[model samples]
Target: MANYLLKRGNLWWVQRKFPVDVKDQLGTFFRKSLSTEDADAARLAVPQRMREFDALIGQVRMARDEGDLFANADEQPALDQMLVRYQGQVLSGLSNAAQRRHLRVLEAFGAFVGLNLTAQQLASRAKPVVEQWLLPSFGHTDAGRRALNVLIAFYDWVVECGYAQPPNAFSGYRIRPIKSVVVSRKAWTDNECELVLTSLLAEAERPANVLARDNAWRLAWVVLLGLSSGDTLHFVCEAQRQTHFKALSADWHKTRACWPEIDPYWVPGLSPGGPDGRRSWQLQKALGRRLTSLPGSLTYTGLRHAAANQVRPDFDAWLARLQAIDLSPAQA
Candidate 1:
């Protein structure tokens, strides 16, 4: 037969001749190791191997004739099943973190549409999901960009496996910067840091409720810690005593990879989903009010850049100078 099993040393391999029209593109014969040494195993593997080879042949032929947009006439599987197969077969050997992220992207896609939907159905609905869900939700972040790339790659794999049609619905998506003015993560200048700290300290010292006082204090440290420790506003909001900080002077690099600590001060009234919904939002609101007096649009991210700039050969010495500044009354 044209497609048959062959013995290669100790393993069984599948060998098949390419159609004449696609021989130049796909080679004369497709040869793949079946990873089995037993003849019985090779014989059992025939039907599935034949199906895979035939699907590949159909994809090449369709790509040539219909330009990658046509699906094979064969019955297609459910979207969920296809995703699982794609992850297991196509991305089997990829890094676990990458694989997990890809699956998460796929899951997000499925949530937007329906996992039970077929490839053809998914292709039809992809544009709206791309514009509405993907762009609005993730258009600004690096993870979003990576997810778009992964989605495109997954579709390409689906087309190649004869699981879906082509011209890939997600192929046109691109990752662009969210802001027109692309500023690098610049740390706060010495003058800017002094201005920010002095302003926040004044706010913290004002008579206020525990919630208001704690929010003001933490928000201030968020700026100082962001600039000095390179921690994000989000990280500052979610910091915990047991996880993020154990003592005043702690080494974040020594902690687990998932939990990164930055600030030395322990926040008293910080809780998950305070009256403002997310604790991060509370910090954001407090910081936003204080930053209103400053020139230019200085985001917390900018503070992180400022702190990064402060990192020099004498980082400890510079940190000591920052630590020596009196914020004890506010901290108390």
Candidate 2:
């Protein structure tokens, strides 16, 4: 149904069905590249010219001898492959991330922080809306800003993979710069930690809200074990379980912990919970399931701040101990 195609090398070719009147214009485009053959030309000159122009002159000559493009086209299947990979692989990959993973993280964050979004419809629109409709309204103070940084990293990955154009759709935006605050702070005070743990335990005991209740109680886990370095909720959930499964979210948040040789996440419950291992391993059990959202509280990043301040021996010594680390006060 198309009138013409600029086959691989940018030369335009008219379809066999093109009208006689339209062929004059098409002929102007096709014949412009033609040149008189020179006796002095090397053997490679003809093929090189053909490759540069992407002309189907041989097929045209054959058509004169017989019929059109030999009644078949060669470049069509290759173009179909390009279109298929672009949609099925690249676009599907990015859209799935925005839908299942990015949207869920945004929801969990908004719920915990008592915030709302511009509208889901706005997020579904073009690039410009992210800042106007999405980012500014998220209320990303220091910790929230860092979380936004993680999303920015995802957009960067999309560009690097060539799914996006150069320069990235989400680049150049800034968040709260959590670094300056991290060093002077510690995760939580003894009282605050106790409050969180107790609140979580009580939450877990409730009959309904099983998911929220369980995660709230176990939220201090990696911090308790000195692993507060990261939390891609779903990946961390999967890593703790140590099994193979199709990832629900985009591949961006995956940790090396899933690959034990690289990731050093604390896999709790080599035995069970409690020092003696007789009590319930509720934290371990909750962590094993697929989480709809991560358990976070706007009040909780104070724990991270507190932990950073409490780092003894010095920042360098503390940095050396952790396998993975992020923003600190000096960098802020």
Candidate 3:
């Protein structure tokens, strides 16, 4: 009973008439035999057959539009040939890793625009396609910016080499800016610092592996050092030797000045390189995890702020008082 359903002899068929504009590319009438005598079966077959007809029509329209856009498409250099020439000329100086990264961005672009287009056709259509299709596909992220940058670079090369016209498609295209949220790093209060140090000291006393106990002790020192001196974890982890109160101290690596003497604190029998020869970063990460397991949300970096908070009106006095504070388990 559908409008497109027809009967020719004993067999049912589905047919549609193409629009006047596309009739030349497609035919005047689209027809496919349903090969069913039953009216109910023919109706079911008509919908699927109509979908196929519509798909074919869409393909014809796309082909017609492409043909119109590039009349002498066959005369232009193919995309693959252009890429090979561009690689040899422009990307030859880059390292293999850098070249591969560029290729990945190019490959994603090629997959979207397709390889059938000539370098000239692509260059002509690049701006609209990149702004509308390519950028939106990658979204507004670091990856999207990288992709945009690579494409712009590629087109610049294309124009310089005389393969394409001037005014790169992606040259001025700007991806939407990423909005960032500001997270406040709050300074730990006196009671909070005491609680964290007490927990770490308690952890150090428990029976555990040498590495675990060493890390707990090191974290306690890191916290104490940060609180007293307002120095970073990196400075503490990288310290080669302990400076006692009476010793003439060498210049601190970060500040290039002699650091004020603090009470010597060292993990018993643990090397400066850390237990089991672990790197500074590895030790820092382990200490960070141990710190995270404690009750408060304040990180190791927050202790520096706590030091400044305690300094208030007098820095030297506060540092002298904090330096003599004992970190022994009973005193913690």
- Candidate 3: the clashing residue pairs are none
Tens-digit per-residue lDDT, 1-332, candidate 1: 32488888999998876554445677878788879988888888877888887788678655554532234457677777676567545554565556667778888888888888888888888788878888888877776788788889888987887777678888877876566554435445667776776665565556265455445555555664565457777776666657664443543222222112244334334445666566576557667777776876666766777666763223344334334333333336
- Number of clashes in model 2? 13
For all candidates in order, the CA lDDT equals 0.65, 0.38, 0.63
Residue-by-residue lDDT tens digits, candidate 3, 174-286: 77658553222567777777677667666655625545554565566556656756766666554444452223222122111112333233222233464545435665777
Best by lDDT: 1
Error of 3 at 79 (Å): 2.1
- Model 3 alpha-carbon miss at residue 102, Å: 3.5
Residue pairs in steric clash, candidate 1?
Answer: 186-305, 186-306, 187-305, 187-306, 188-306, 227-307
Better of 2 and 3 by TM-score: 3
**What is candidate 2's lDDT per residue for 1-332, written digit by digit as tens?**
12232233543332232222223223524422223343223232345544433444334323343533123433222222222222333333343334344445434434433332222222233254345435555555664465565446544544454444556545556656434444223345555544444444444445245445324433434333232433333334335433433342222123223222333233322334566453234544543332212233323345445555662223232223222322111222
| lDDT score of residue 6 within candidate 2 | 26
Between candidates 2 and 3, the lDDT winner: 3
Structural similarity to truth (TM-score) of each candidate: 0.39, 0.22, 0.42
Q: Candidates 1 and 3: which is better by lDDT? A: 1
**Each prediction's Cα RMSD?**
15.7, 22.1, 19.1
lDDT of candidate 1 at residue 85, scale 0 to 100 = 60
